[model samples]
Target: MIKTRVVVGVDGSAGSAAAVRWAAEEARMRQAELRVLIARHRRESFALDARQADADADTSTVQTAVQQARAVAPGVSVRGVALPGYAVPVLVHAAEEAALVVLGSHGGRSFFGQAHGSVCSQVATQAQCCVVVVRGGEVPADGPIVVGVNDDPDASTIIGRAFEEAAMRGAPLIAVTVRDGGSSTAEEALGTEIDLQLDPWREKYPQVRATREVIGGKPDKVLLQQCRQAQLVVAGARQQGALLGPVGTRLLQRAECPVLIARA
Candidate 1:
């Protein structure tokens, strides 16, 4: 089992319910514990509802969600939490002790693109571990786990984590590399290099079958395509693109499945 664990944000919404389910399965497959985090709405503290009432409500909802997760993921150790702070800061604090932080793509009531949803965006950008965004599906067996790789120094880490996840879940690893090879000769050169990188992965995790493909066009198109059938898609935060919206402005928001951006 991984030394740390996965913490998922929950807010008693359908999307968060999906997040709870996804995080539970991932933790189960990894033999890691699942932490169901319910960030106490700071503003709620001053609401018409008394502190005891809101706390009780939040705690009860978290308990129910944890029970549901236990039912869905039989053997996974599930834990509940109703934290007393804003979502992002509390999550970042939790991340200080987790291997992965999982969340729903869209928050409990906000669009994924909200400029004010600092918790989700901040956790995605600043978390020290892998941050997974479960966007579209909740069915456990929907599709394969996709990984985006390049010559970036973090590529190997991405490969290892993706392979580990795929192997545990008995899912295929869709290893994808986006190439901006300007011409036919350039394409061949980059494609060969891509092959070399993937070659080592085949031997490293022989049980997890992998397929490599090149996106000769723009980077975003290639990534989006790879994630179309992905149950989980992972990307490394390019040092250069750290300010380019975590996973990238478009890819982060448009991915069809959960997008895990690895940051160590």
Candidate 2:
């Protein structure tokens, strides 16, 4: 049987290092192979000497990241590749056959930058499979897996991923639905809607301890607040647009935990 693959991009930055560690743990949990990739741009001049130097440096960076992954997850199969291209397209192409594509929130001058924020946004929006942006600080080994839910069609997919994550980590699942109204009636109605949505997932993962929360606030704000205590925050990717929806975008930009955008 072919093993599922988890692909991650690194650029020798702290953020990418965090992504490598997080992706390593994720691959270990899922029993998947980890593929670490680095993208490099060749100068138009194409000096053979310069080209060889760039290849050697890029190879070394990927190798360091591979060593980090092996150190973090010894039992998982891991490899590294240094490819020539821009970061966005190379990683997106890698995502075509991957179960997940992991990236850091920041990058170095070579591969990623704050500008790569756009790169992360683009890849998360365009990748064929799920995309995880490792943000904030160290990933918590213990905390509830949090998911944002609504009446949207993608909510089920988002919640399902959350339960799978929680089960894999042996963590509880907190399903949150946010509303702008403070009215008790509105809260109750939204609560019922959330319960109905979570029902099937609850039955599907009986081993996962799950809870429903109806919070009154902006979706992104409420979810950001929850991120403070979450191991991972799962959100839905808007299928029709070039961007993830507002909540997903904000979480990608500012969430206190790694954000997983479910692509369906």
Candidate 3:
């Protein structure tokens, strides 16, 4: 059987280092190995020696990140690799064996535009396992864990992961369901469905305080506000050719906390 591991991407940036730290803590919490991956894209304009020099630099960067992660989570399994490929493809492929993939948010021009970096957006959307994009300022250690739930078939999977995280953190879990342009009847129905769906999860995690909120509005707007007081925000993602599901994309773009996208 394949061993479960938490994978993180490093680019020698402060943001990437932060991702390593966050991922290391997560791996330690889950008793999983932490794998740090760094990608060096081929640059045609550079001479052979220059390209080799860049590759060597990336190797050093990966080693430094591994050291940092080890420091943050002592006794946790830490490993690093320097791969030859573009960032998005390499990271997404690595997700195949990863229990979770973590990466930092850095701005760059892409098809998704400037609000989010292309690699972060693409990997989060395409990865088979859960993808976490670390964004926003300092997160409160005492903040609740918020999760978005809708009528989508994958709501149960998303809720399950949220409950696990909340239980591990010893924090409460807030489940938000939105009814857009709907009447009270619709809201009531959704609330009932959400409650029924979360029943088993609540039982499994009896110690985890689970709260449900059924509101009338756009999901993106509601979750964005909820993110302000949340340590992490969880959302479901549907495969859209080259983009994430609409709600997931919006949450990643504007959430005030790290967003976890569970791809379906």
Say which candidate scores most in TM-score: 2
**Which regions in candidate 1 have their CA more than 4 angstroms from the true location?**
41-49, 107-117, 138-142, 239-241, 244-247
Off by over 4 Å in 3: 109-116, 181-186, 239-243
- Model 3: per-residue lDDT, tens digit, 203-240? 99999999999977777799899999999999876633
Off by over 4 Å in 2: 1-3, 107-114, 239-242
Q: Which is better, 1 or 2, measured by TM-score?
A: 2
The residue-by-residue lDDT of candidate 1 on 135-167, one tens digit each, is 756434748888877777877877888887788
Q: Estimate TM-scores for all models.
A: 0.87, 0.94, 0.91
- Model 3 scores a C-alpha lDDT of 0.84
Which pairs clash inside model 1? none
lDDT against true structure, model 1: 0.75
